[model samples]
Target: MAGLAGAPADGVAQYRRVVVWRHGQTSWNAAGRFQGQTDIELDEVGRAQAEASARLLAALSPGRVVASDLTRARDTGEALGRLAGLPVTVDLRLRETYAGRWQGLTFAQIDEQFPEEAAGWATGDVTVVPGGGECRLDVAARVCAAVEEHLRGLPENGLLVLATHGGAARVAIASLLGLPHDRWAVMSGLANCNWSMLEEMGPEKATRGLRWRLAAHNAGSLPEPVTVQEG
Candidate 1:
């Protein structure tokens, strides 16, 4: 079960955990091309990465698994679902940023072609939309919403494994923190096949929503709680 603390349907404070798992490496990712809604399947390395990572995540005993509609993300989630014995829920809203013109272009190509716009886009500027793709703000808005929607449906003491893209993972974390556009730039990008954990810190006595904390970032293993002994 996750540490997500909030008033659930039973009118009691329940806790749950969310893991934002980035899809494994893809050929486009290796080539530094912007995938953005592209249906690129995972490369051979990606399949191996997914299997290894999902095996580790199964240790957390996630209650449910959800993934983006894209093949890369779907396959990654399916890996975890198979290991955890959980059904996967697909939601298009969790899709990667719609990087219109930049979909297949490399960062260098984007910079060389649209120098001015590329800088702002790279820095997470809300107004900059590389190749008319979805801006950082738009990506955050939908990704966070989709994740929270699933979070709201889980048992108080459950874990949600979200298989998504790097950009969506970064935006979801920043947006949940209520950071402005400028601050969003400071959130580092998620590496392929890595995952971050957000824990709910709100009190059971409170009547408000859960307060999330960055428990772990870019983690390859599930952190188990342990207590020190008096030697």
Candidate 2:
């Protein structure tokens, strides 16, 4: 809210947008393990990715920066907030889906441990939880709530930036697009430090209802592309 000023009087304002970005590369991301609710820190390359994302976002001049309370996401948000000269707001609801017993485990490990459940998940069954993990629907509900809250508080034509994780980002995007939870597979995975922009039009415009349009993804200003090393 710090940088938000001169917002339009109409509920729908031009230039108002919501930008969503996945946090930079993390140790688990490199290793291809499930992060779930586990609080993992970003590796060295992740730090650099965060910095590069910050540089790209600085050019957009977003008004507010919001992020998941998780360390990896918070750290990424902090970097972008500094670049944009805005404060970072941590929102717990923006966290990734809880992986339950699968936390920190790689896909192969999960297959070895809970083959059936892993197979079910791969097939897009929201209720299949190998180990007490949250169902996909549960994640969708929480993410939708958080996004709704964020949208409600936004000033007309204000710009908001959110830093989050892969699972959460996918859920949020799917919900915004009014797509089925199972269709999450259709939405591409966001690259580390990759950013996406969406615009929500107010109730008076032609699109006058809550609608989100994709603006950008995997976009950054880094001189060199950030390479992701598999763990």
> lDDT by residue for model 1 over 1-231, one digit each (tens)?
222222235554546778999999999999999899999999999999999999988877899899999999999999999999999999998899898888899989988988988887766787677688778778888988888889877787788999999988998888876676678878777788998888676675234654777777877765445443697
Q: After superposition, how far is residue 184 of candidate 1 from its true place, in Å?
A: 1.2
TM-score of candidate 2 versus the correct structure, residues matched by position: 0.83
Could you say which candidate leads in TM-score?
1
Steric clash count of candidate 1: 5
User: Can you give the lDDT of residue 34 in candidate 2?
Assistant: 89
Over all chains combined, what TM-score does candidate 1 have? 0.88
- In candidate 2, stretches whose alpha carbon ends up further than 4 angstroms from where it belongs are 1-15, 201-210, 221-231
- lDDT digits (tens) for residues 1-231 of candidate 2: 112223335553485587778998888899999888999999999999899778877776777888999999999999988878889989998898888899989989999999888899887776776468787778778877876677676666677888998877876777776777667677776888886666665455436554666655555542332333699
Q: After superposition, how far is residue 190 of candidate 1 from its true place, in Å?
A: 1.1
Q: Could you tell me every candidate's TM-score relative to the true structure?
A: 0.88, 0.83
Q: What is the Å distance of residue 222 in model 1 from its true position?
A: 3.0
